[model samples]
Target: MSATVSPIREPLIEGGKSYHDITVDLVRSTEKAPTRLWWIAFLISVHVLLFGVFCILWTIWHGIGTWDLNRTIGWGWDITNFVWWIGIGHAGTLISAILLLFRQKWRTGVNRAAEAMTIFAVMCAGLFPVIHMGRVWMAFFIFPYPNTRGSLWPNFNSPLLWDVFAISTYLTVSLLFWYSGLVPDFATIRDRATGLRKRIYNFLSFGWTGSAKHWQRFEALSLVLAGLATPLVLSVHTIVSFDFATSVIPGWHTTIFPPYFVAGAVFSGFAMVLTLMLITRKVLKLEQYITIGHIESMNKIILVTGTIVGVAYLTELFISWYSGYIYEQFAFFNRALGPYYWSYFGMMFCNVVSPQLFWSRKIRRSLWWTFLMSIFINIGMWFERFVIIATTLARDYLPSSWSYYVPTWVEIGIFIGTLGLFFTLYLLFTRVAPVVAVAEVKAILKSAGDQYLAPNTEHHEEIMKQYKDAEDKGKVYGSDHAHSESH
Candidate 1:
């Protein structure tokens, strides 16, 4: 069969064949070590997950009184964790939904895992609010359904209600968005399956045939979903901030909370992305696919968002002082110098000062340094939430109401248990799903960059010389041309 050349430039393999035409057996090709690493992760996460289950059961059997919450120090690790996990969720949506709208190609390497991270982190976050209600079973009271006992509705005016709406919306939208991206990938696996796996993959694939027509619609739908998710991302964090903004509490009530919280969320989210991508890129041996350039791009975002967060901190302090509200002033002061001052200082050092190092190319490119920075950013973000919730609640308006809150064993166990939940979901996702988008990879592999195509230049030069010799022999045409010119 004669080869038909494509009008568009096609990616050439070492032998000048199209890379897109090469079929990969992912099961055979994927590294054994990565699989082993995932198995180890699975085993560890399961143990921790079981431990979390025990903590939940113990908390349920005992009661809310088993924990350290009081009237004064009502919110503690629960709220802190909720905010932290939710913030982690933001990075995925930002990378996939927001960056996609901007047509950023580098996002392809990170978006899949980030989206998975978003879903899992949100799951971890949703657990806190439910469990923190003391009577875990009675947590449904936050719902807006009509009650038989009285005509009571959840307070629409409350930030807690806003959080309920925001988080539920965010989770629902994120799941849909993530699932939509998975459909084509699931089809790829389905085609490679057999027996029981075939049936399961068929169910998941929903009859995807990789038709060009279907792909066109799929692309359009993905764009629409990305657009929807982008706003939802911003709104979710803004509403989370409103949980603090609407409160009459001094440090918590600030106009700057929305942008500040969003910035902080993106900052923490990118850090988590870096943490996961660094490991995955190395473990999966996807160096050519992910590339150092992708890591550098994320590092730039981390630096930008981290600086924005830093500015927000300074702004919060400035506003707190400028408002002439003594309570606000005191709240800011207490954050820096109060009993929990060390946590606040830790937050500043980790979030504000630590990420500045990423501004340098050397630090951003080093995997070890990026890993350390990611961990530091996570710790700092958690501390930030703690400072916001714990410090604010610890010292309210009245001295009589002032009290210290310490996490009981149950509280700490539940907190540690949720980490298990996050990891469990993440590990499973990496194993079962295409951790990277197969179609997008195929598409990237199809695009030939701006390099001139060269094929056997030595042979071509010889052919050109032969053509020149043949042309020189056509001097009869030159003689005819001279005769016509003389006439």
Candidate 2:
């Protein structure tokens, strides 16, 4: 007797949907009126957003003194939040651009929402530096435009200046990439719609037709943008890291900052993506399109990036000890055993220990555990930022200037407000746009379609013969006709 082997199964999509079915299922979300849950979520987000706006206005009127910053701790919650949000935006590019270039079919399900999240998160991140300037009206001084200040220009060598160029370019390229992907789907909506929707979608579709030539162009354009965005994503966080690494501060001055920050960014970004997608999948009834397999794949990425970030943390400690620099060693020591030791430990637990749960296949596949882990990762990443910014600044070499920094209600409100802003935009996006890429989902349907399992070669041949006889007998097959006829 010969041993039998079962074929490995992999489904990037579920429900055995056709291309037309995918278009209808995804586009219906945009066409339908807001559900009760959507309304409730939107209203709550709006209220929170309004509160954030009020806080911003109040801060503007009260000036920078409303927050808890002193001479010792010049940077606090504002910069921390800025870096945190920016880091969260990295997963979008990684999923859409990097994964696309690498030919990862799994990206088709989640890339649309991930890219949108990137835009919203970056917008939220951009607010902090502007608001932290105190005189928000004079924020244009960061630009290099000629002014009446007699050839005085923004410092060309500053990483802060580099951030302006980097973020703007990133946002622009991401927007174009996202919108370009949406064009064909928008045309699909326009064709299926009537009256007011027809007119609106027509405009949004930018006169796209399903011509072969057009698709060829679209594919080329997408590939080019993905190529451009790959480096931009790496550079953006690298420059952000420069904001710290280039500094004279002991904790901030390390050559490892670039790669460390990039890994942390991807780690945090994936966490946020999972957090939102899990909620969206449940509420929007999109489990078939964004299946359990998709969740598992994303969890694997979180585990990998989380491990990388953990390694970076240990490397930082090792380097601090090996450098033979007193300030650097003390900075690392203080982070682990200082007034903010709780936060440092929190970072270690959330970022390093919690993700280790995913090593088990059962835990990786469990929705609840995955969601909880994602939230924990975000919490750990936030504390990591706080530990870096506060612990180092609070305990400088000069004891006379040493003071613990704490965020005031104003700073707290601003951070919460940014959350409100991000959610508001995301919720609105869910309503107005197809949360998943309809076209890409349709393309992958063949791979994820129903499969027949046979225990052995004989069984598989027997099953195929039966199907062949049925086809020869003029039985109508519902699957791809060419495939059935060929057999």
RMSD to the true structure for each prediction, in A, is: 9.7, 8.4
Residue pairs with colliding backbones in model 1 are none
For each predicted model, how many residue pairs clash, with residues at least 3 apart or on different chains? 0, 0
Q: For every model shown, what is its TM-score relative to the native structure?
A: 0.86, 0.91
Model 1: how far residue 376 lies from native, Å: 0.6
Pick the TM-score winner: 2
Q: Which candidate is the best by lDDT?
A: 2
lDDT of 1: 0.81
**Candidate 1 C-alpha lDDT tens digits along 194-260:** 8887788789888889899998998999899999988889999999999889878888878889999
Cα deviation at 115, candidate 2, in Å, is 0.3
User: Per-residue lDDT for 88-168 in model 2, tens only?
Assistant: 999999999999999787899999999999999999999999999999999999888888999699988999999988888
Q: Local error of candidate 1 at 389, Å? A: 0.7
